[model samples]
Target: MQLASNKGLTARNDNPLFWSLRNAFVRGDTNGLDRELRYSFQSFLLRNKFSKSVTASHKKLADLRYPYDWFPATRAMQRTIHLHVGPTNSGKTYHALKALENAETGIYAGPLRLLAHEVFARFTAKGKPCALITGEEQRIPEGTDRYFASCTVEMAPLNKRVDVAVIDEIQMIADQERGWAWTQAVLGLQARELHLCGEERAVDIIKAMCARMGDKCIVHTYKRLNPLRTMQESLQGDFRKLEKGDCVVSFTRIGLHTLKAGIEKITGRRCAVVYGSLPPETRAQQAALFNDPNNDYDFIVASDAIGMGLNLEIKRVIFEAVTKYDGGGHRVLTVPEVRQIGGRAGRYRTAAQDIKDNHTDTTSRPTSKNAPAGMPASAGLVTTLDDEDLGVVQAAFTSEAEPIKAAGILPPTFIIEQFYSYFSEDTPLSFVLARMREMAKLSEEFQMCSIVPLMEVADLIQEFPMSIQDRLIFLTAPANFHGTGQKQVLKVLARCISENRTAHLLDIEGLDLDILDIERGAADVNNTQYLQRLEELHKSITLYLWLSYRYQGVLTSQHLAFHVKSLVEEKIKDFLDNLSFTVEGRKAKRQQTRLLVERHRKLEEKILGDEPSNEAELVQEGPGAWSEEGHEEALMEDEAEAEDPVGLPDAIREVVSDDRLPRPAGEDVRT
Candidate 1:
């Protein structure tokens, strides 16, 4: 109490008003001392007011219990929601898309860029003014001020008002990693009429959302246009018996290639392949090859990538195995996965062609929004490659998936920016993100989106000095941080941004030119190391282009990155075309078919052994982060295969667990 000589007290006492009061005290002047004391009291009141204002701001940013109120513009408008609920091949998307086509101004938001491209192409072919927008790519028609938009879900324009909107694969609202995008589109899109197309499982959840918003919800249920039957007998592990219109579905890149090579070797017919990691353009090219009847590619060797919006003309669906490695661990496929993949078979082209023929003039065509619904396709057949998988596939087809309970959500950028202001400038970003997620007060209808990947990304770029806003932008960029050449490129880009310099892919340090070159050999096609490098390079270039769009002048190598990406895709296609499974010996052509089938069976046994049958343990699951132990185990298996010709058991134990393979340019990669 007697420490007026202390540094803090001495500094305060040195103020002019304090000096006046002290001088008055020393001279015994009571009037001057009272005036100085009044001045001090007024200063205290003003400082307290400013402190209260800051406390109020903090409270406002902390109140996140009502996320629906964030989008005030959307809430003020009267909206009508249409739910197109049906199984695959039931024309749900077709009808919803038709409504979008008829509207004066509308948007089509799909789960994949491939689907967005397809819709954009269709609208352009019909001579409609349309624009395509994805994370990495944007195409705007010349001289068109008013036009339709086709975009991926995450790229949907929330600020623009439209007459109609269509959101495909609405059931994805429950996805753990990316579901927030779907939920955001549904809630924030300023549309007079919004059409949501997907399975019936999403109906109740969406209706609940609409009820909260006071929007009218109307659900249209549809039955499969064609019959589908599960076969009792499997292929009995015989690749020789695969027919012309068969699609053999497997869960791994190696497994699909093995099937493709073995079938081509034995049957003397070419096979096309599709998976998640392959570029969407590459997947489309393969599908086109298989769909053309005159082509030598009479069969498809694919992963679950065919499940969503990819229309293939196949007579039968053959399962290589019912079990899949879902990043975290080995798990059985869920009911939705089995149904969606199995439903790609038996497309009815002639019926759709008949309708197209009747409507020769696009201007005079009847809109599907109000027209009566028509029949869709023909009967689709489903079976298994081995007897062990048949029972599991059949059971999955008969079962139903659990209904969704809540939509995923994350704080908007502005909300995050305000929250960041509460922390010191030097606080670690990972810590800030974790604290925000923990402190968030979520409503019962919404759950916090996974921030693990964001946190991981924050840790990777913590060494770089940047503003909080700039740091967030880098944190959200869809770039790989895994131990690969791509990770090196990502670090370089971060360094450039931190230093406020331009980034160019070609100018990056230790850049490998060989990644763009194709390795010419049959063995190289099956070489895991070679294929992984190719995929990594392709994804890295794509990530560069994605950032260039956002950063514009800062990342100035967009043109070169685009050129390299196309070249890489072509190399990938060439590699897939020449891929084949080879054995130790080969005899005459007639005997080759028989001998190859036998060897293929032996090869499979050596890799996967017999399938397991623990029915009770097959829990319904979603994609999750790959466990470190599982990834280490897979690396060890890869090493074993390189050391010995006989492959390690469970070599394909940990496939990329995403429903689709690694995402393309605009999409986030699984950790």
Candidate 2:
């Protein structure tokens, strides 16, 4: 019977333990059965233990599970926290707003007036009391606990009270022209929670800053919602095969228009264009037309200005040229610029499916006979634009004139030092101190002066042989500082100045110069007879010095030996009305001076007030807070009358004030 039971167990595909237990039971041995059952259970336990260990090892290799040591701390911190950090089109703005919708009070600080207006409209649509504040506009809702301010850093003080403050495009904090405002906002904004959004490179810097401030900082990276597909071949061939909904990106305005015209000719559809020089309304209209799926415009020709934040429904992107003429010289495209523009190729909603089918070839060969080797090839994605030579120009205006030395590139240290030499030795170190005095002097003397003198100086400096000219070139060389067409225009201007000819600035409004060959273009310029006249003028020391000061290598080059002569043949009129100290009698002269000063003050006010055209004058308000009594009353009433649904306890309320909120308890969120 035991043998039969064991045989039955074996036939059922049971384990050896099952057969052992079955034989014990069949023998009617209680103690044996107990022993066999315990042994069988012990074997099952050992198998489970081995299986668990293997599963755990796999999880560790895959990083599928948090470590036992780290999970508890991470999980606790993850509960009340939110993060906003990513490249453009990564839904940073969307996620931040979602968090704001749940918060009791929220504030959004945007970079531009127009952006602030857009955000104001969005919040207003949600039935929230929102405010829009820019240098040109301000619409603050009275007494509302929640507010939205789309203001630069200068306006940060106005948004003193808020639960959460979101700083969009935190990368602007490093901007040369307006970085101070962003930096001030980050350091000075008084909010319980700060949410920053920008490029990934800015993450570590922001985290470090937050950590120094003793705030807990957390970083979150969001993958690109839409990634561009690779080009099968380079984009150097015939572009007729370009599908519908393609964007042809160009650097120069002329190039943009030329491509738009060419695309329209080929596709039989009107092409839209968005460039920096275009009016805001025109750019917005073009953006809308290009984004519209059913619109007659099937293509867009744009500059890098369209590379950020502008949403487009595009299937392909064509880079007509990879290089752009930065004001100082030609520069190659950086990875961020390429990624920003190329990232627009596929639509965010259908990236995976659409990107595969939309893959086009991008080739890099010598351009065709008519095309110039416009600029250097792009340095691939992830390459930083923070070259040391470039950093010198960025930090030039500061007191610390860090000498920029780069291999293969000319050092701009001597050039910058020469330019700064214009200031007196006693000059203050602060830009603000210098600016205040300059503004006061300008207001007293040249308040109504025409811009022609400044323009002339800029022109002469372009031809100037002094090293300072090189400094100016380096200063304006960056892609963002100057337009892509600036290099060609500057070269033409320099050639004209060298020949001593009156060079008429080309009006680019409707010109199609991009199609012209560079060699042919140079030949045409030489044929104008202006070159001969300019060369003759260059022999004079005055003209030579003017050119030297404006151009960099001219004065330093050993091949060029030119003496400095006064260039001003015509008497240069001083813009300022100089005050004279002498008079026939001392008392009479003093009285005359006092009367003149008062008269000048009134004239200044009237001139400044009337200077704007009718359209611009429409929104002018007398300088003051300029708010009506009724507005203030309404604000007070709105704040005093509102009900507090949260019934926030005294413990929290004590820390909250009219101008600032209580600081948040959780780890600080860094972009």
Candidate 3:
């Protein structure tokens, strides 16, 4: 992309360094000095493109500041960006998708995995070969040439050439945690025609970004395709008055479950629950139940998980409370979230007539053509419980969206990792990411890719005795701090790296095989206690999937691991479908389940055999071993053992569950 001068010879102003070098050579300067000068010239050519630290005191990062300069594709393409700005129920995304559909080659980057999968399905169904790429899953049809791809924004391929690229939810760039992806996409995505879809509030920010990036920006302001009106009155915390097409929004899992159970108990109607932890498949199934007119799922109760690109025909949105417990304390929902979730009610479009009846179309054309058969089409309503924030909800009714101030940014994995290698002697494992950011800010190629994975993976691997590579692998895996399977996963990864082989579950020795029991494999059968373990296992599987993507051919066992994941998922799915637990007095429930937990404990000891147990073992039995509350309480009893594993090497950091505690060699563990 460097512009060349019309004349063959370099201009005198630009050739000052060239002349200086020539004069030195003419003056009979030492060959060693000439060699050093030539190396400097090589460094100038590479600039930020590379870094070389042959020894100490030789590294300078002056030429590596701009992220856009790294990508030839980004530099060469003049973006034709169309901003589809509007409120919910508007055809903003519809117009954007139409352009993508008509393009010879394109990509659609969505916020949610469900939305990305849906778009991928839609394109592939229309006889266009498409790829679906998400962080957890990737699918490219067998023996097909992909011309388009639908993926989460983080997975958007920057190097590929395409006619069009659709970046959805452009306003999320202001999000404190995930907004960096949208910013990176806006600044770095190399596409001929870029469609940015989101609320009107982001219009100005996007225009400024486009101008800075040297891309032509076209603003398309739109009104709601279907009107959405705020309800004058609130629900006053009443669940009995709820009917079909009502969406009750709660912020916590406990509250959502309690509300859903109460609603079902009173109205004798099935309810669909959508929460973040629920899998994409489960969420889709729940939405399908609510969308189908004939289904028993008359009402929907969900968390803020429904606040994004999910489309549903909710007649009314009832916020259970105005304030949410945001980790630290209760806080009011932001104006943008209020609008995004509220807009789900009364979507404009409807299903094609005679889809299930006169037309009898069974071709799976897409949800757009299948769902929303009957709708009011005119207006929607957004309300809250107890009138706590009626004014707040109403403010979003007319006000523009809140402007985004900053985007999230993660540094390049390889570059920052290399930087850290030079400082491993003094650097603590806990601050690896923090240090990477500081160094990345100093780099020349630091423009867009600063969006780091916001969540911490595992309680930083405790065993520091292992190599940096092993520790880093564990750090990067999306592992739960208290997960039982993480220790084994680390062992397996170490073995794999050592042996230069992929590992399956059976391949790892000394693993607590008792976890294979998805149903707890015990007598009294308190499935609730087993569920905690299952959730941990699910997270472990997710870590494997993520690692497999990073290592590709190195983790060939991921496909087999998925088979085990399916078994665990089936148990989870069935349990959630018939969600229940013994709801009796704590004394009564424990009395009935005590003998059961004891039997399970003895069986687990037999499984562990003679292996010396670590203090880190998480005991499943003891007081509070039935409900999720009790399970957590039981875990808390071993709180002293759950030290933050920041200093230990990943190899020795054991995630021992107290399925059993120590007893005399011959005596049964006290129940």
Error at 553, model 2, angstroms: 47
Question: Which digits, one per residue and each the tens of the lDDT, describe model 1 over residues 1-671?
Answer: 23432432322213334433553332222333453455445444533443566756655775677877889999999999999998887778777877887899999998766677778877876778999998778898899788999997888999999999999888878775567888899999999999999989889989999998989999999887667779889988777877777898866555566567788888889999866456656766887787777778888987666676667777789987665544332345778888888887765442233234634322232212111124223557899877766887899788898777768778888898887787677666776565565346666667666565676677678888888788788766766444467667777888888897998777886455576654755455445565556656766776688788878778898999888878876766565555555432111111222232334344334533565421111122232222211011121112222222333123122223213333355432211
Each model's lDDT comes to 0.66, 0.40, 0.57
lDDT of 1 at 256: 65
**lDDT, candidate 2, 1-671, per-residue tens:** 35333443331123434434543443223444564465445445533433565544423332311112222322222122234666555666666755565566666765544345545655666667887664323578998755665553345552255667777766545442334345555655555667777666556556655543445666778765544344434433344555556676655443455456556665688878765434345656776676666668766776655454445556666665444433211233444455556655554422221233432212212112111133222211111111212222222212221111100111123322432454444322122111221222111101111111122233433443434444244232211101123334344445544455554222312122232222322444432222222212322222223334444343332123221111111101010001111112222222222333333334334433433221100010010011111000010111111111223334433332212223455411100
TM per prediction: 0.75, 0.41, 0.67
TM-score quality measure for candidate 2: 0.41
lDDT for position 403 in model 2:
16
- Give the Å shift of residue 64 in candidate 3: 8.3
Candidate 3 ranges with C-alpha deviation above 4 Å: 1-65, 251-258, 274-286, 294-296, 323-330, 350-377, 389-392, 395-401, 421-433, 436-477, 482-495, 498-501, 507-529, 580-671
- Candidate 1 regions exceeding 4 Å error are 1-63, 252-254, 274-285, 292-296, 350-377, 517-526, 582-646, 649-671
What tens digits encode model 3's per-residue C-alpha lDDT throughout 1-671?
02112432222233434433432332222332353365445435534433355222123222234544545668678879999988776777877987898899898997766578667756765678888887667887778565799987778988787889999888766553345567678777778999999888677767766766788999988786655778888866566777677898865444455567667876889988876556556766887788777778889987665665566667788876554433212235667778888887775332222222322222222233212335343457788765645877988777864454334445444454565565545444444443333233322112222122221332234333556565566554544444456556655665575556766655655343355663533565454455556656665666667777777666777777778778776765555444322222211222222333334345444643444422111111111111121011122112111211123232212211234444445432221
Which 10-residue window of candidate 3 scores lowest in summed lDDT? 615-624
